[model samples]
Target: MPHLTIVANITAKADKVELVKNELLKLVQPSLKDAGCINYVLHQDNVNPTLFMFYENWQTRELWQEHMNTSHVKALNEATEGAIEHVSLQEMTGIE
Candidate 1:
């Protein structure tokens, strides 16, 4: 089976960029340790400091969903409430 790829784009509220960034950073270590996680990398836009992106690869869609339900992810949601301007997510499978 092909791996599941996730591309998540996040835009932070103008005043809350650093807060959102710190909260997002807290997810990295735990996500990397999650079952079936092939890789989880975070990126920040060069031209827009308030924009952030996560490029993730998982063994399966189910495992990626599991990662989304993890405690750390939950905490991230709670911590960033109202601090985000917009979020977009794309789930894809690499074409081999």
Candidate 2:
């Protein structure tokens, strides 16, 4: 089966960009350690500091779903409540 790819975009409230970014950064290390995680990279938009994106690859869709339910993810949700403007997530399979 092809690996699962996730593209997640996060936009922070104008006043809460740093807070949201910090919270998002906390997810990287832990997410990289998760089972079946191939790569978990975070990127910030050069033109728009308020925009952040995560490019992730996992061994399978199920493992990626498991990662989403982790404590750290829950903590991120709690910590950034009302601080985020919008979030968009997409799951894809590489076309190899």
Candidate 3:
């Protein structure tokens, strides 16, 4: 299967920016250790600390789906429910 690329955006409530950021950062290490993960990187907006993004590469789309079902991911969802204002995720495949 072709590799998958994921681009995810996260917006946190102003007051909970640091908390949300810390939570998201915690996922990186474990995500990288997952079987099909090629890379899992997190970034923050320069002017807007509450805005974050993730760039991920997985060996297959199924692997990425498995990542979503992991305990850490579920924990993040539950923990940041209100603190996160918006989340946008995009999955892509290279054309060539």
Candidate 4:
């Protein structure tokens, strides 16, 4: 069973949402191929063009921590540096 769940809330620059989404897609597709990652998804709110949510499921907290330290993930963080106004995260544990 997956041990850690990650959720990230993102907001992008006004006209750069599409571009941000594209970058996120590129970041996540490769991330999902990692053994530690179970899934990675980005959700855009219908009412807010600049708002997005990232949900990632990891095989273990250790692996998730490792993922947080990876270059691609770090690049993704830097990629959105000035493009985002707010960034928050929530992590949950599955009972199963």
Candidate 5:
């Protein structure tokens, strides 16, 4: 099966930017250790500090879904409640 690519765009409430970022950062090391993870990288918008993005590559769609279902991810959801302005997730394939 082909690898899966995910683009996760997160926009935080002005006052909650740092909180959101810290929570998101906590996911990195654990996420990278997942069985199917290829590379999980985070980025912050240079011009817009409240904008955070993730570039994740997984071995399969199922594994990516598993990543989302993890306990830490669930906690993250709870921790960031009402602190996020927007979230956009895109599942992608490599054409080249």
Candidate 6:
């Protein structure tokens, strides 16, 4: 199987890093159990306090796209509306 890796770099504004971390942590399970998701993990940058990373794995690209359109995704998008500086996402594939 060709596993999917989603790399997300998130920046927090207004010193809201902790707040966003807490919010995002609360959001982990919903995404974890979503249809094609194999794993969903979140981490904070050591040097850059305001930066966060989310590494998500999925069974397929199509299912990952579906996960992005779910209601929980919408809620997350809304949660970070004013508190986030920027978010960048990159999709990659695992290699043997």
For candidate 3, give the lDDT: 0.94
Across 1-96, the per-residue lDDT of candidate 6 in tens digits comes to: 788999999899857877788778877989998999999999989888889899999999999999999888888878877899998999999778
Cα deviation at 10, candidate 3, in Å, is 0.4
**Model 4: runs farther than 4 Å from truth?**
none
Query: Model 5, 16-91: lDDT tens per residue?
Result: 9999999999999999998899999999999999999999999999999999999889999999999999999999
- How close to the true structure is residue 77 of candidate 1, measured as C-alpha lDDT? 98
Better of 1 and 4 by TM-score: 1
Candidates' C-alpha lDDT: 0.97, 0.97, 0.94, 0.84, 0.96, 0.89
What is the Cα-based lDDT of residue 14 in candidate 1?
91
Write model 4 residue lDDT over 1-96, tens digit each, in one string. 647999988888888788778778778877887778988998999999889999999989898888788888888877777777777899998786
Cα RMSD for candidate 3? Answer: 0.9
Q: In model 1, what are the clashing residue pairs, if there are any?
A: none
User: Which should have the higher TM-score, number 3 or number 5?
Assistant: 5
The TM-score measured for candidate 6 stands at: 0.92
Clashes of 5: 0
TM-score of each: 0.98, 0.98, 0.95, 0.86, 0.97, 0.92
Candidate 2 residue-wise lDDT, 1-96, digit = tens: 899999999999999999999999999999999999999999999999999999999999999999999999999999999999999999999897
Error of 1 at 29 (Å): 0.2
Q: What TM-score would candidate 4 get against the native?
A: 0.86
**Can you write out model 1's per-residue Cα lDDT over 39-63, one digit (the tens) per residue?**
9999999999999999999999999
**Stretches > 4 Å off in candidate 2:** none
Cα RMSD of all models vs. native, in order, equals: 0.5, 0.5, 0.9, 1.7, 0.7, 1.1
Candidate 3, position 61, lDDT: 91
Error of 4 at 47 (Å): 1.0
